[model samples]
Target: MDEQTGSPDMATGSDRIAGDNIAAYASSAHSPTSESMMSGGSRNRKRSEVFATHESPYFFPAHQLYNVVSMDRSTSYTLKLAAKIDRGFFLASNDWTCYRRNYFQISACFFIPGLDTTQQPEVPCLLDYNGELLQVNRFLICIGAQIQNGDKAIELVQHTPKRDKGPQITPKRMPVRAGGDLSPGPTGLQPYVVTYERVQFKTATANNGKRRAAQQYYQVHVDLFAETDTGAQILVANLLSAPLVVRGRSPGHYADNEDDDAVAAAAAAAAGAGAPSGPGTSSSTPYPADERYPPASSSYRNDSISSSNGGDYSYYPNYGYNSSSYPYQSLGSASHMATQDYREDYHYNNNSGRHDSESYPASPLSPSGPHPHAYMTPQVQHGFSPAASGAASPDMYSPSGFPENGGGHYQYGSPTYPQYPQQHPQDQHHHYHQEGQQQLNGQYDSYNGGQQYDQETQDHATQLAGLRIHSPVSPSSPLIGSPTGVTPRRQSFSSALSSKKAGVGIAGDRSSIGSTRKTRSISMSGITKRAPSKTRTSRTVPATPTKEHHSNGGALGSIGGVLGGIGGLGGIGHGVKGLGISSDRIPENPMEDQQS
Candidate 1:
């Protein structure tokens, strides 16, 4: 049965001519019914024009492996050739198909032990299509190619000294290993496999009027395995290996006569009349991943969807939301463990009770600490604390000169302190009126302006006082004119009130707390008059040395800590105040923050 002509229909002379004409008609019908086919051919042509495009993979099975030039590793085992041909062509070529003059160029890259450098590796074996060994073609050798043997890997590339060679011995192509190959080791011992493929098609004039072009291609892929027997049958396990990656060319052959101008012109006219269409070669820039598809690495675990695990993770994205592209969730037991860490830190601050603030430790210059009123309120400044002598330096509060004392303590008697107000008649009357009022419950019953206000009204007054009030007048504005000792009166009043209302000390650590509160009060009094704000300090934890200490072992640990502490958390409490972040509210686990 003539399969290409589809089992010829049995008939008489009339039927036979009819069938022949129909066959010719059918063969001539090459209108490329599918757009995908045309597009693929156009794209392939474009690719061939822009960048050198290679042909489909070549196939030279095991029996023909050594028919070509071959070399033995350790003088015992022989590397075999096993080309995983592109399925497109493989399906087209069935068994028992004899091809002629089909020449192929092949070279083998093998791993050997004694190499000192990473770049100069060994290139073994060269052969032609007939399996006839070629003369030691030094030009085909690749040294300094990266190879890995278990833990020790090195780059032993072929160094082509200044000699006559076909091509420059630059890094020929990126080295790729077959599936299940181990990564390059630190030590300089690894092996690689290289293969080559070629193809050709010929036509001839015969008695028959039919025209035809014969096509033939070759692919040579290497299979390296450890073996105990000298027969080279037993496949030893691979300690370290990569895919069967080859770097070779796919040169298209124009028939000898076709290579000439007259032949080319005749061939063009024939193609114009009725020539077998070229295979719909894909024109799409074969995304490197698509250009070659290898068998899935056997070493890849079934559940590992990511390419990180030696698996193929190629995808084409559409504009709309794609569930597959979303941040992938692991499907294994370890998935939940990943979530625990995230949720731990996230929940911590969500419910933290104590106000979180950015502490500015007092300058350790004048025996005293940060000013009592450095912050808007004493409670708000609670987050700041002096570092231990061996720790990092105290905060930089005032960029100006420190007090004369090394402890940062300044006396009120210093000339820098403004004088207090005199006992004016209006103030006296207000003081008398305030004495006349009685405390309702434990809270104050009168406002700062001497108005007898209820509890709600007192709360409202305090809130209004904390609101940042802008000073329209510049420091050099006319508003700086005399307030008649008003500044002194204000200082005395604040001092008196802070002294009387120093509530229970937080953390029960009173040594610096009392002084800190006092310093906070004084600073607050000053900042309030100028840039009024209830600025609170955020509690800052000393950063753990994640990066430097655990860089090699745990990359994420250091990264997470560095992110969570200084930079990530530092910028949070800048503008807002009274953001109480108590310990109980914050989860103890730092990982709690990982949850969405």
Candidate 2:
């Protein structure tokens, strides 16, 4: 779109370009500076810069986190856990205060194939955050709250995990370290009894990028169960009742060092005596083997917990502590004494279209490869360009890190593990200082006493700011006057008036029966009025072409600018002639309708 208009380019350009011949715009015969083709330094960067702004706002909103699952018609269920640390914290809350304070909401859109009609299933009171049954539906959930009526919404199917009784799969035991810290080898640990089922989403292909996008989601269903002593259960209840804490441990780390051989021997010994236990075996008291391993949460477990007394237990320091009368309290309950920890991991699909790869532009001062210290590393072969190859130049590397042969810029990598060329500390400081100065000078439009503007306004301002371009016309005389002796400003005013008159002419012309035939042909042809000649050349007394008039290549170049000369005039004239009309056909003076 023209920079002056605050609308999308397609909205404005569609009408003009659709009626005009597409071939005309697509033709390669036009000069380099023609407005039809995007060029010039600022014009090329505008689209890229706007895209960057949309993907990376000045600051991210707390509630704007999003995740997407791809599902097809064959899939009927999907399981999803909150990904972000802050998001997980809110979802793990039992008091519902997090929901109230943060206006927590999750939006999921499902589409299935071949389903004419379906009602949202009634939310069941099945499981609490602590892996216990709710017993009663007391939590306020806006069920089946909103559904889009289009083809995208009706075909969706989703399945949340249910709390159920299953055979408690217990881990084998190995030697327990002094403090449950498994060293390099031979630590006795047991696996917890947790089972997970697959969840799938089924929907018809609908509103994705194109015909290839499926309109459904699918996931594996999972249920986590653990048999615990009163101490461990109390600790589990505490974690479930409060905000989730990612303990910074890997998911597989806990089960890694368990003594599987010893646990197998123990299981064999128990089976010989007929290990009497039913499914969901926590009730059985035949043996006290459950306390051998701490009851920890797993991926299969619903990441929420709650207690019968749902008051503000989180605020109390000793809320999770077991009864003071218990004998183990003297040494602290096994739950409080264990070295158990919680850890959260953020995983994102880098292949998705919406992901941003770089947090900062490339550093101009760096000579390193994407790997840190790659330039100076002795392990890598010496491939640095020699000083004779112009390696010392800051502009040697393109922003994308390939040779600067005027190619397009490339993104560094995903935000999580960005592969950036190493930059010196001084370069980083310079970039930060430049950004700070821009903020101080009001370039960001977002630093007004620390208050934030609306997202829409910020987006609009960003687009506007990026649209600025360096004009080819000089400040001394910006307008290119017509060759027919009319002043440029007068011609512009006349053109504006002519545009208004064309509106009335079109309306009146459409109404008149006599003009219908001509109007129809004109409309179908989409004929535009011929514009005045834009070519002119400076003259000298000896009938010789002035040096200022004829630039390189025997063309009428620009009369005032660097390219100003007679060489440019020929190109412009040739372009004008190619439009199927001559300069003589243009009106000397445009007439406006008397209706004002």
Candidate 3:
């Protein structure tokens, strides 16, 4: 069904004729019953004067009415009607449209002019054309297309009610009061308020089952009629709502237009092409070959060789062996050559009964057979040949060659090679002992030199020891400072020697010779003695005499006295003692004294 009102061109001839009849009826003068009811006289009543005293029933303009009307659950209806009325009453307008599937309500208030401003302005009673008061119990509602300029009639389209058994036109009746009755009381003289409640439009406006134009418009026509005494219908008051623009059916109802066959065909093709094959089933079509990888040749697969004897195998064509510039003709020839070279250089001998053939079988490429010593042989021997022999041999110094040995080739440590002599354990011991003895003799020689140095040191030290002694006094001589001259006791030789060694003088005075005098003392014996101090008439016995004078005097007196006396040389002792006495008293020679 069309969503809008039908246009003039789209209407059939029958539809146009029907439209003309409707227009004529709507525009014609009031019917005989209506006129009689209004005038209470003849069926043809004269029209009212231009400035008539009585007021007429008419609809208010849309602008003068309240515009805030809405349908439940609808986003439409944002724009509403608003206008001024000449009667000074601001009434809601019914000059707008509504969408299909939406339930809406329309309300209009009727008022009689000439009413007191202080009293209720509502119409207390609806008067007929005859100036008689009448009650309007209900109104008839209908929907039809808007009249065009040249159109003589309005075309009404089919309408479906909301209920199965309800009238084909929704909201066919609208009661003026709740109980559909107007009692003869003050309450019954109520204000006239007409309302169409919860009205829904199921189908859009159309003509002859054709689609609607975008600008097509429809109107809701309301009519109130009263039954005369003769039972004729008299049109009392009627109103036409604003032009309505109805929309088409909702989008959810459009599924019925799709093509099921075409949809099924597309789904089948996609499934067959994209689905994977089952495990038990094989694909009928073989995989297409790609130009990127060419197929392998039969020779490449059959003659492929691998490095290991048994394992997972990967096949590749032998590339360089087939070329003429390659050194070895085949793999087997290369292996055999390496084996033969190893044998000849090392002197492999098969007489040891270890078969070389068993280790390395003959190569297919070398058809004559395996090399005689292609594999290792037990008892491999090595021999050294002189450079002048004119034979190709490995260099003895090379790391890979056999170790060099003198006396020709022989087993390790064998008697045949006698370059290194072997010694008995006892001889090794004796040899060690001789070396130790030589070291001891050297040590003894050094010790003897040290002894000679010590002897010289001791003799010098003895001379220094004598210098520390005081001149000895004779037993028959008087003490130098004694009062009675009672013959001073004689000190024994041992006591005199000890007194000198103890570093003390006979006069109880410490000698000027310090402890280090031993190191400074030098023996002047067997050497020319330094001349004695010049004799002075007033000889101040020199304090701490020169080291040379001290050594000569002390040595000659003390050591000579002891030696001479012990050797039975009394003259020598007397002369030495006199020299000691003279050195302290007068300068004289000990030899002169000895001669006297």
Model 2 whole-model lDDT (C-alpha atoms):
0.14
Residue 7, model 3: Cα distance from true site in angstroms: 45
Between candidates 2 and 3, the one scoring higher on TM-score is 3
Off by over 4 Å in 1: 1-104, 107-210, 213-226, 229-231, 234-596
Query: Which is the winner by TM-score between candidate 1 and candidate 3?
Result: 3
Better-scoring candidate (TM-score), 1 or 2:
1
Q: Name the 10 consecutive residues with the lowest summed lDDT in model 2.
A: 53-62
Cα lDDT for residue 250, candidate 2 = 27
lDDT of 3 by residue, 1-596 (tens): 00000111212211112122221111111111112122222222222111011101111111101111112212111111110000101000111223343333332222212222113211123323233333322221111222211011232221112223222222221112111100011111111222222334445432201221123333333333322222222333322332233333532221121111112212211221112111001121111121011111111110001112111110000001111111111111101111011111111121122222211111111111112111110001111111101111111111111111111121111222122111111111111111222321221111111321121222332222101111111121111121210110111122223324433333223345554332212111111111111100010111112232233544333322321221111122232232121122111332332333
Rank all candidate structures by their TM-score, best first, as comma-separated numbers: 3, 1, 2
In terms of lDDT, which candidate is stronger, 1 or 2? 1
User: Which is the leading candidate under TM-score?
Assistant: 3
Per-model TM-score, in order, reads 0.16, 0.13, 0.20
269 Cα displacement, candidate 2 (Å): 64
Q: lDDT of each model, Cα atoms only? A: 0.17, 0.14, 0.19
* Residue 71 in candidate 1, Cα distance off native in Å: 26
